[model samples]
Target chain A: QQPVQSPQAVILREGEDAVINCSSSKALYSVHWYRQKHGEAPIFLMILLKGGEQKGHDKISASFNEKKQQSSLYLTASQLSYSGTYFCGPKRGGADGLTFGKGTHLIIQP
Target chain B: EADIYQTPRYLVIGTGKKITLECSQTMGHDKMYWYQQDPGMELHLIHYSYGVNSTEKGDLSSESTVSRIRTEHFPLTLESARPSHTSQYLCASSGSTSGKETQYFGPGTRLLVL
Candidate 1:
């Protein structure tokens, strides 16, 4: 089943912070985060494995809670370049095909 | 910086036309996948391959078929395209590394069946 993403869409001002949450009914093995600009491919942002591991990028971070079967991506000091659709995909067991959420539309205003 | 590529960035064709979407990756990834995405919507996995000669259907039932004759190439073919088949086809590849199966994507082919 596809994971659920919160805040279907969000508008943010530059330098503001936003959080996107993804939860799945099934247990998760790893969570993958990707960002896609208009008419472009989804770019890999980060991947959070099980064991409650957290990964971060420049002002972009993500956390995975294995027990909760959920993941959260944090966009700190959001920039205009951060404007895009964010997708969270959680992998369960040996499944190679990832089921992506509907995606969280993030708009950052200058 | 992943070297995945897709051909025919955009295609507009009439219904009943046969088409093939090509995807190739130079990163030597063991796994490759094809995902169909509608504009501003979630992606649905159509097909995937673990390596050359190993193709499998994805969670979403797709009418298109895929082939993995070479490790770096996975192509999708539609014998007879329909309007319902119009969608963005995204190709992605990932290495076999455990706990680090981060997939890198191609620019994608936006297909339009008239």
Candidate 2:
């Protein structure tokens, strides 16, 4: 099943912070995050593994709550470069393919 | 940079035409995947392969078929294209199943079926 992402879209001013959340009904082995700019493929950001692991990249950080079957990505002190659509890909069991959330469109305005 | 390549950055074709989207990776990754995405939408996995000669259908049912004839190449073919197939096709590869191994994506092929 596809995960659910909250706040389908968000707008933030420079240096502001924002959070994008992803929740799934199924048990997740890992949660992967990626950001995609206009007309481009997604770029890997971070991966949160099971057993409550956290990962970060630059000002972007994410945490996976296994018990809640949810993940949250944090963007701190946002920059214009941070404007993009963020997707959460969840890995269930031993499957190679990931189930992705609809996506959260983030806009950082100067 | 990761060595994943996709050919034909953009393609426009008429209905009933056959088309193949090419994807290649030099990272020696064992797993490759093909995903379809519309503008401002989430990626939907259409097909994937674990290794050479191994192919599997993803959660989303697709009209496309893929081949893993070699380790570096995984191509998706549509025998008959339709307007519904108009979207961006992304190719990705991962080194392992650990999830920590980030999946590297190609630039993608944007197809417009008229």
Candidate 3:
């Protein structure tokens, strides 16, 4: 099943911060975060595992709560380039593909 | 950067015509997936493959079919395209790195049926 993302859309001033949340109804083995710019492919931001281990990305960070089947993505000092639609994918360990949330559209303006 | 690629970044075809969307990855990852998404909508998984010759339908019931005959290629086909089938098709692949896997996506193909 697909995860649910909060704050369907948000507008932020440059240098501001924002948080995007992803909640799943089913237990999750891992939660993945991705960002897709308009007319571009979705890029992998990071993956948070069941044991609370986080992997990937340089500027952005995320936290995974396996117990609650939720994950939150943190973007600090957001830049204009950070504007895009963010998606959270809750995954179960298997050959099946990750289930992506509806997505959060973030817009950063000067 | 991810080496995955999708051809015909945009396609406009007539109804009832068959079309194949090409997806290829140079990373040689064992896991590949195909997703369809309408503008401003969530990405829906149409198909996925763990390895060569292993193909499975995803949660979304799609009229499309996919084949994974080669490790580097996974293509999706629609036997008879319709207006309802118009959407952006994205291809992605994931590889394990120290027990964690990161998926890399292609540019995506935007298809329009007239």
Best by TM-score: 1
What DockQ values do the models have? 0.79, 0.78, 0.82
lDDT tens digits, residue span A14-108, model 2: 99999999999998888999999998889989888888888788898999999999999999999999999999998986547887899999999
Model 1 scores a C-alpha lDDT of: 0.92
The deviation in Å at residue B23 for candidate 2 is 0.5
Write the residue-wise lDDT of candidate 3 on B7-104 in tens digits.
98999999999999999999979999999999988899999999999999998999999999999999999999999999999999998888688889
Q: Which lDDT tens digits does candidate 2 get at residues B58-108?
A: 988999999999999999999999999999999999886544667899999
What TM-score would each prediction reach against the true structure?
0.97, 0.97, 0.96
| Interface RMSD for candidates 1 onward, in order | 1.3, 1.4, 1.0
Candidate 3: list runs displaced more than 4 Å. Answer: A54-58
Least well predicted 10-residue stretch by lDDT in candidate 1 chain B: B94-103
Q: Chain B TM-score per candidate, please.
A: 0.97, 0.96, 0.98
RMSD of 3: 1.3
Relative to the unseen true structure, what is the C-alpha lDDT of residue B22 in candidate 3, on a scale of 0 to 100? Answer: 99
Q: Candidate 1 chain A, which ten residues in sequence have the lowest lDDT sum?
A: A89-98
